[model samples]
Target: MAEEEKSIFFPDDSHKLWSFGDTRTYQRLSSNSSGFLRQLFIVNIVFWAAFLIYFVLTASQPFAVQPLLLAVLLLPSIFLSLYVLVALRSAERKRLKLRASGFIIYAPLSQDVFNEHCIDFDQVRSLRLALHKRHFLPEEECLIIERRDGRSLVIPFEEVLTDIRRSDFMARLSAYRPGLLDLSEAPALPGEGGPSFTELWLHDFATQGTRESLGLLPAGGSLKEGSYTVDGIIGGGGQGNAYLAEGPNGTVVLKEYVLPVYRGTRLFEDLSARFFAEAKLLSALDHRAIVKLLDHFVEDSRGYLVLEFVEGPSLKELVEKEGAQPLSTVISVGKDLSAALLYLHGRFPAVVHRDLSPDNVILREDGSACIVDFNVARELERDSRTAVVGKQAYMPPEQFRGKPCPQSDLYALGATLYFLAVGQDPPPLTNLSPFEDAAEARSKDPGFAEFDEIVRGLTRLNLEKRIRSADLVYEKLSRLALKRRES
Candidate 1:
């Protein structure tokens, strides 16, 4: 006595049968009443009647020939009709069994039992609804079961007059597979049919609304088992949003991948992997001049990186508020940045900050500089699939073509320094040397003379002539700082 399993029936006759047991749930769908089947039957009748009329009008042979012709023409229709009947009957007989172990789809053919499909619970990734419509069929809903390894199975439902059946189905599904259909925290669903990357990117920025309205979790939302509470959204870009958060330890910054819509695409997968790797790399490095990664986690299909909260405005903000800084402060900040870059590049497999711009550098209250936002950093062993990503003004020519190296970072660093010195963005790189501009800057401010040589060496148009390593730049800046102190 299984305690007389509870049964819920759809009053609208949308679902053929549904039974729930303590250990399992069962569902059977009717296809005969489907809009698709009825339309198909009507179409077949129309075609058959038309053919009969045409044969009666055009027949020149005996009446016996007409029967043969009709039979020949109608064979395919008969076979199709039989297929539809059998399919509908089979669907009505099919039982979807849900157990703690997994899902089993079973039906009987003749005297033998047929298990059409069985899926292990571990392989199940998510379950969602898909709207499918065909020639004669009205728009119908199908339950789509998505697997972790990127496979899917679609189960069509019977035509129900109300949505109550769908609601019941979802409720039962959630009860059986609690988190499977909860895709809010799952990574983006993978598939190919969506808006283009460029279109999505444009839409993300062009649209204006609050963080929650734009699909971002609002401030005060708890994350990582209540370990971190979001303070507010600090910044965002094409890939993700950065939030200032507070935790038990102290204040931290959380960078979360916000593009849930791109989850199943190759681009989403690639970027997600890179984001995790970046978190790992940042966590391993120990430098005061570099933002420290505290932890990383995946929530609601979105990846997040927890970083140490730097308590200061970004260099870009500082400059915008208070024009150019003192030469000594500029030189000190440059030297600190160079040291951070040296540590990154000195690794066995050098890390290149592909998107080094003034905005990426933060100025502390004590006048020290720390490099933040390594979203586009990559190892020296570059992959062919790496896309060119960075600010146009800061990116070197080689970087624009997807070939970034230590020299490319150097060019950006020089450009950043130039902006700091002149209180404005540098002109686009052409045949004109940045040194010529630096020379004019030196005439206005003598401290620029000290950095003119360094800036020129670092921002050379030709890669062959540019300063080769961050270490070398650091060393040169260190000497200049020492010289300035001595004088």
Candidate 2:
């Protein structure tokens, strides 16, 4: 089409180009439009079959059908079905145009043209490319547009045509405004000029593979109707289990909660509600020091959470295998855990990790640490009736009484550092004075004196005497780290 004919507004409103300024336009149909047409056709056929059968069965003479009654029933059905097909066809051909300022979504055929279809670039918050999983069928790739107001639009890719157009659109969008979109969860294009539609599809196909080994559910069997393929079991408790699974994007840890209560009972409903609500809050957190909650759902009366798989060993396992780490390593790991706690406590509604211990902290190959297992974490609401939960060796006095605050995490952090230094779990439910425990090591290295002092303050029996917050702990650790490096 000529540049003069291209529309700055709706592509269907072509005449406006002549009166107003003209700009470039791109168009594509919504991929889901065909699915709607197919469903409508099926419903039309089923209704006709049912109506004919009922009329024949009720008739006085089986062979003699009244033409007037038949016409009354059949004509409207035929006309309405035709009208619906036409409307769906129109929607299938409707255009979505991308321009310099923003993009335009054509209104559905049944909706008014003035409906909210035009969206500016500024309104867009993120663009995530993810696969939409389907049962016993190929997963469909889609673009999820998250708006600033928490609304989102999911548009599935339309095979080759849509993929090609998307690559071009993304390129032009970047040229128009560099770094305007957050594509952290999106895959990279093949080359500097971007990949062809075929190349991109092929790359996606390679990553989404069928598991070759047996798991909790056989090699190919899945949970949540094939959304997640269980590869192996990672951990399990009496009430639940965790599986290493393959998700659409990549590897994930699928945590299961077996809610054994009867579905109709009030207890079952409350448990399900609380499980999903916490999942939502966990998903909102975006930080490297914490595990990310990717997706969540319930099936067969059991709740499941899809989490990012952090590839590393837990601090407990690392310490057990490697023995006591050096003072420098202890300080480094402490800082990472402290920063994670600071972030958790710093949220608008502060979060308390009721159970923080070496067992839940992972040490990655890159040498950074991240906190995991938020099953016992909760937003701080100062509820006196809060459940008492945590490892006995790491729990503070207040936490043991079911009153955990942000400072409780600090106490646990101190115990974790002691484990890293002493290579064994600290004595349960006691104020740790690690100086005596590490006295022999302190005699070898004077720095252990300072490290032990920090741990002592953090594990003080009285709340008033204990290290108050993650912020203060981080500052002290930072100075200790600097002093070690200078020496």
Candidate 3:
């Protein structure tokens, strides 16, 4: 038989037997093989009949077969014929039916009770094809359906459907559920062939495998004269992704700035320049409570910053896992962060961390805090017409009017502290009176009373009335810390 004869059977215009009500059936038929099975059955029957006749004629002779020998010969031929017949019957009954709602597979030879398996489209998350290479024939294809809950169903196409019919089925499936047909193979990990298209699609494009594919430069790959190798994406935001990378000194956090929308635009160039400037400022900054920038480089039109990788959860994560912190712990964290901010303010250019919240502050294992995510931080002497940025709930009143001084960062710290004490985010600035909120927070826990005056000083609505500098805030928190220790 021709190779094409074994492929899936598709009905033509003249052959209208496939449809039954609203369902369409497809089958692989041995009937198309030019009477091969029928011929074999006839030949076997004739040979067996002749042998039985000869045996009967010679039954009385001494050379004739014994009863036991005759029984053995007859049983073997009968069993072989039955086996072939069963196979022919099974081939005739096997089929796949497709309906508007779902698909049904029928296999009479299998142990299934009803000899059928039905599947609904809604259970499918993705559909992919696997190819099996053959030495002397076309590659065999199998369809894999991955469900949303992680179960997978494999449907083999071998001797089941024709090439044309399989193509039609795939086309229909794609039309019914676009983006479900995944043509790409399973992706390799980093340092293997890098990530494949399937990995990029399945992952959120923030893992180690998909960095380069997402256009954020590759992790585990070298950068900056082979001094740093990105490991994986630690976190991500609207601006870019931050990666845990390895450097000559030790592990560092690599921040890559790649804005898809700003590519090829003047805004991209401006932001890139600002990113470099920030890197330089961070490299110069050396403080125990601040993430240190070790090195920086620009590659493939993307800016990269190598920063100190703090090995601890952010304050946000800690608060979420362990609810409200002890007042003493909160005071210590505040004191450490305030000192870090004072260092920034005391710089010659006076850097201001425009966006400082619980998420940006890492709580080290030793209970100390480190400030991170300086992507939006700006130098006081540069760019007066910068756009407003920072979390709205934490922004000072002047920040809403596009003027953020050192006091603005102090307000954010107050809001962050309030969250730590109250186990909830403070109400928006418009609806909130910082002093009243602080007093109410203190009322909840007597421990918060010592920090109420500090919170009020930091979060005062008027810029002039707010904490004058990070230095003063640090001094106040230090005194509170000292008092707690004495007790």
Candidate 4:
């Protein structure tokens, strides 16, 4: 027999019926209760008594009440009260479903009140709890959800209370988006009702105590309607910025591409289209040595790419801390990078990583290298527009002229290796000769000469003299590493 799905139901007497299941859970709110029925009965009696008194005072005949007249007057009042009770009960029959990605508020009778009933975690801007009380009735509490598009959803809090002793309904809501609900209270006059604590929390959370900001997004701010929360910037360049963020999939690097062109212009549209197309292509790639592209989007007239976060330090940081790397370490990194490039270049029509540098290579904790930063990458095509992109020191002559080919990446790789083998950057736009600068490597490894030859060939000024492909580069590095191991 198939095992029954495990679920926990709230206590029988609770106004809310909460059921927790494996894949789906829901909180059902109903207004029908014995207490409400008793209240209604009492109200009907009082209403009829008031009507009888009014009729007697206004009657022309003294000490006499007509049964037919009384029946006609009280009938409408009874029907009106029943209609009101039905409407109120219908309005309270709401269901809150907790989905994997977000939550849904289902109010079949009160659907017209909200712009949207389903809300993703990213769509939420801020949440607030407010209490409203009138002259003689019990206080009513509501949860107000403010969205990014200036719309709001007000959910009654009374029926949402579950019988769970450990956690309440609001606590469950908070679990959906950690740190989302601001526990702080918003200052307000005793009777004011329009504004709540959400506005104050949002204002402080976005500003971070600074009136003026220098970056495109604040540290605690979110993007894509709150899907990704920015922790802080990881890196930035002339064209874009990269941020380390917390997302549904855990830590991710958010790369923002800033297009200076005005929105709605031909240039802007063209740029945006190309960016998305390239992003789509990149997202299809799966390689252990390459940082995976998780997602991409455009918001506020800027393009953003979500990439898997590499756990280890960049090659640049490694070198900065340890000075020049050992010959074996350099060879391992070279082979890994070459393999990654081969995978990219082997794609149909070819994908050229126009930017490759020590700063773009991250060494994993397991010592394998992962190539990152595809902001300037493109599919190989001779007729494509030339955009001067990449660091000057690592960029070759062709790349500086905005005409990078697959070999342009080889040159940058050579420069990166040169920085690792020797403790400094090679001169830009010049052929590299490692004899004078690689004494430290030579002292450490006897096979440094062969490695230097590979670097020299890769950084050659003439295209004909440069190393041909990532395959060839990988072969050469493998041989050098093998020889070192044998020796």
TM-score each candidate: 0.55, 0.55, 0.52, 0.53
Model 2 stretches astray by more than 4 angstroms: 1-216, 266-270
lDDT of 2 by residue, 1-487 (tens): 1233433333333232112222232332322334444656776898788887886899788768778877787778877886775555443423455544455554343222212245666778876677755334466665666878788765554531331356545544443344665667565456567444323322322232233322244555587678898888889876577889999999999887655333223343345434544575687788888999887765544567889999999999998899888788888899999999999999967988877898999998888898888887888864334668899999999888778898888889999999998888999877786678876667777678888889998998789999888988999999988887788
Error of 2 at 350 (Å): 1.1
**How many residue-pair clashes does candidate 1 contain?**
8
What is the per-residue lDDT of model 3 for residues 1-487, given as tens digits with 9 covering 90 to 100? 0111111222221122244432333333323443434645775788678887887787787365677876778768766776765565454434555433345555432221113445566666777767744334455565666777787755555433522244335433432344567777633234555433223221221111213444555656777678888888777877777888888989888887763332223354355445645765676789999888776655444557778889898988998999877787788889888888899888876888988998889999999999987777977843244568888878887788777777888898888887787666776573233335545555655545567778877888987778889999988888887776776
User: How many Å off is the CA of 290 in candidate 4?
Assistant: 1.7
RMSD of candidate 3 to the truth, in angstroms, is: 25.4
| RMSD of each candidate relative to the true structure | 18.6, 22.7, 25.4, 22.1
User: For each candidate, what is the lDDT?
Assistant: 0.66, 0.69, 0.64, 0.69
Model 4: pairs clashing at backbone N, Cα or C within 3 Å: 122-225
On a 0 to 1 TM-score scale, where does candidate 3 land against the true structure? 0.52
Candidate 3 lDDT for residue 322: 92
Per-candidate clashes, comma-separated: 8, 0, 3, 1
